[model samples]
Target: MSERANAMRASILRSHGGPEVLRLSELPAPVPTSGETLIRVGAAGVEPGLDVRTRLNGAGWQLRFPHVLGASMAGTVISSPDAAAPDPGTRVAVAPNISCGECAYCRSGRDNSCAQREFLGIHHAGGYAEFCSVPTRNLIPIADSTSFAVAASTAVSFGTAWHLLVTRARVSPADVVFVVGAAGSVGTAAAQIAALFGARVVLGSRTPQNLRELSDEVRALGVVDTTTDFAPQLESIAPGGVDVVVETVGSDTWAGSVDSLAPEGRLVCCGGASGGEVGLTLRDLYRRNLSLLFSTSSTFEDLRLVLRLVDEGRLRPRVDKVFDLADAAAAHAAVEAGGLQGKVVIVPESAA
Candidate 1:
């Protein structure tokens, strides 16, 4: 497809700790095998959870990198042999989950629940470089209406939100949804998705910038606010406690997320950014019919369904910053600061 393949680029890994570990290094370009497709990645996601996992010594994630960082990407299919399933030159979104496909869950369309599942950036080489490879089956064709950057940013974040809201939470019109960390990519998607289902959307974050940066589409859904106190503030707004909470802040907001839940409200958790331990009251747990659901990457089917909404203008992704794939160190520093209102992206070998 390309005149040539395999070029060097920057990648990161902290020496001791912090964002500095992310250093760009020269590495070989990626090549796709027979059943695989070679994607000349145009955009790669730099998510907070990705940074945390990378910093935590791999944290049991399926994708790996002492060299690359980025679990998700969007790019054009540069090369795919006729034997490939997705076809060549298709603009596509890279699904994060990597599986055997013959697993029970995979056969049942529950690949996210596959016991042997491995995510892209977490388990294998991810999109932080100029090119990445995947089985043709993992890509869903992107319409002319969507851009490569848009396809790249949606995979893990939006797909996960769809599974939590539509599949597990079963959000309804009567529900009052409290989305913690409301400005982050996934948090923002969760809020928007729930609102689309007719649920009342309520947002909370630590900064006014979050309230300001994520304000546009969130305003279209419902009320947006910055609150430091979770219980009182949520109660003042929702009154009877929230019916659902999409929490990724972890221990920092755990009590607050739980406190704000109504009797039968459920909390769907996918990350733990603020640390993991929390103080809880057993009486509250037993008396309230609160449910806690945990999930990982989404299936291609969920990605395809969600992307249809994006193509139709019902869902729009937020991108805060862009960096060359080699400048992942800068992206990590920005992420660690905790102020970005949207997902950061890395472009490989295309710019300074």
Candidate 2:
């Protein structure tokens, strides 16, 4: 390898176990292949359980080992193999969810359902490095006014929240929405998106401090009511029940999410970061005429909409802190410790 290529650093998971397995190592910088671009990674977002799963190999997906694990990232383009690719030095957010373009789901614009969809840090190498390669089509230009941390943090949290609220549940102006786990990344995003739609948002979390902080942040965006007591609070405010429940915490919050909804209400779930399964009765679901929607990662279009919202100042991510690339192990540990109100971002020294 050339001298210049030998200096790149990355966090690699050679074996599954705990946060200690993530090692900072000097590796050759990635070279952009045809229709791909090499990014000088400025920032990458961390989702606690997801990172832990990748580290522990518990995500129920295949891995090649020695994997780079970052799902959402933002950076400047340093190299591109296609004329249509963003020029070098252009700031961009990398959308990690790469769906097969030839699939029917992709053709219908619901690419999140594409059978052959691949995710960075999971299906392939990802951005826990100084440099990483991504498809040319996945780059979303970042505005000069926005920071890379914000750009990196938005796609998974805000995009998934946007899909759950606007695309799936069809949250509208007249609705009353309850966001379970309203203090976490996806929870905060859900609260903001629901409020942005003019819905009366009820933000709920087990932690009082987290609830207060998140509620304060979203209040400037739109109307919001917060609670630690999920069911009782919803009943007190809406009486009949809420129009939609954004449940991402799973298990612990699942039953309450179902019970808190009104007749024909929608419960949109995209994750279970809490790590457990919950069961529901068929009779109860049918009787309530409730709709249960299971959403996965965001679509390419969803990411674009979120970026547009960020650009318009209608939406913004709550970034807790930025860790240096070498401190990736510490970043994972902090996320696993919990009580974070926003994303833990990792930045390369070159960008810093």
Candidate 3:
């Protein structure tokens, strides 16, 4: 807690061409600058995207490296020096995108869709450290009832869900929401968040196991009706079609996700795990009046709502597994493996 107390932490890069390049080493720790807070990172998520980019030159999918390997983090605020430190011992989940808030997209309240958005763990230094600085605006206060790990899992994973489903998709009571790739982190978050908004959640994935995991989480969250097939299942449930399609499971299921929508049904997209190219016929879109609503991250306002929901105990995050900072590579491997029941996190405090 001293100003001159130099900090040592880890910074990683995998040669940008293969997983063998994922390397970690100690470096001077970060300090919070203006409008930022120095969070003593408890855990950082080693997501599936991190593994793909590490192993396959992730830039192919728009992933950039030479940065810390995690995008989501949960921890207590340790310092804000000039500004007020977030209450000591308060577990805070941080949303990582740092956009130039003065830009056109930002002023229009669409920061998540900003063209020049600087992503943490992508364009900037991120959460895989003893202490990483983040904008005060990016922190979401987790209730005492929530764990640091759960809160951290929400920052990006849940925040993205909130933005896509609540903000853009705007699921209403009784809306039939079909979430594709229904078991990934975002998929799981979307299903729970959608159901909390009163949507009847339907989950579709490649395997019954994946669908089963999501069904379990959904039911625990009060959502039922998870399915592995889209065509017959959609016809069975909505008949007319699903009211909202949360399309995070790219390439592999986009066509199906899109096909399951109703006349006015909206599609809120986030990630593209399977592949990016989704080929569909114009006949389906033009005839149905289907809307594609793409979004990401909870706004400052959206974050507040999500936090309130957490406080109300209406939403809970599921953890797949946790790894220490040194085992970051393994964590990424787990995410890419994908049959996970929930999110994978990296504990910086994890013993090497």
Candidate 4:
């Protein structure tokens, strides 16, 4: 192969700040090391919360310049030296979370909490390129029928939602669940998962039009316009209060989320897109008997389960838009603009 053929096109962040920082350039394609598989990236999901934050401020995580910033991706395997790894040409979804298997959290199936966990895009070169080198263990084979865009979009949002609703909150059929920021990818996944579990799901969004449309699309039990005071609106939906609150929008909706919960209610938070810090009242927590929980990324099991669901047609992963590799900067700008109903995907030019 010629020198240029050996190189790949990638959107790299040389410095941090606005969407303009991401530039398309030729970088040497990654070579798979022992136990790692090189993949030709087909699609990479753009997470508004994570990607946007990482682009704007590095998300408080230490970074090396010329970083690639896609957290979740799906692609076709090229080659792997490890015999146990999937064969070349296999379609797969790359799991973003990498945890040491010997850790107690991994042994207990709670790998998302592993102390030595690392993330793609943040800690390593990611899929915002024509190729990526991923650990063989992170490669989960996807069905031939699953589109790269859909598979790339599933792991982060759906797995996180599953972890929050199924594992953290333990939502039940009798539970009344309210999902804040229902228009975003994670929020939409959370609402759908809660509903599938037979919970009465309510949707909330600051964009009234988007909220109303999403409620109708998801067939949520009710809707709450987050532009104004939503506590009273939620009160009418569930009478006293909801049994579970899926809080992804942080400070902006934190107080209201706590206030909208019923006695013995559970509030599971997975993101802080709006802001992180929030004040709490000791009296309110003790008086209502509320359970506050926080979840990070999802475990391997969560990723597997969600992927199986999507493959089986039980869960539908939405792709809001697709941009070629060169347009990654615009993709980030779109995500930051908000009001998107589904995930925005970045497709490498070669794949497109």
Candidate of highest TM-score: 4
Q: Count the backbone clashes (under 3 Å) in each candidate.
A: 15, 0, 4, 0
Candidates in order have lDDT scores of 0.76, 0.83, 0.71, 0.89
Per-model TM-score on C-alpha atoms: 0.90, 0.94, 0.87, 0.97
lDDT of model number 3: 0.71
lDDT of 2: 0.83
Deviation in Å, model 3, residue 158 alpha carbon: 1.3
Q: Give one digit per residue, the lDDT tens place, for model 2 in 20-82.
A: 898999777888889799888889998654566777764787788778999889999888879
With a 3 Å backbone cut-off (N, CA, C), the pairs that clash in candidate 4 are none
Kindly report which residue stretches of model 4 are placed more than 4 angstroms away from their true locations once superposed: 1-5
> lDDT tens digits, residues 1-352, model 1?
4444556564755342666677777667666777788887878888667645565455654433355667878888877664755656677888877888888899999988888877776667778776777767888777878876777778888999999888889999988888887878888899889878988888877764556544555553334343566566666778888889998778888887887888988999888777877787878877998898887767779898988898887887878888777677787777777767677888876522
After superposition, the stretches of candidate 1 with alpha carbons farther than 4 Å from their true spots are 6-16, 60-66, 213-216, 219-227
Lowest summed lDDT across 10 adjacent residues in model 2 is found at 220-229
Q: Write the per-residue lDDT of candidate 3 for residues 7-100, one digit (tens) a residue.
A: 5556477456544456668767786788888777777776565334634565544544456656777778777854555765567877777777
Query: How well does candidate 3 score on lDDT at residue 114?
Result: 73
For lDDT, candidate 2 versus 4, the one ahead is 4
Worst 10 residues of 3 by lDDT: 220-229
**Judged by lDDT relative to the true structure, which candidate is superior, 1 or 3?**
1
Off by over 4 Å in 2: 1-3, 220-229
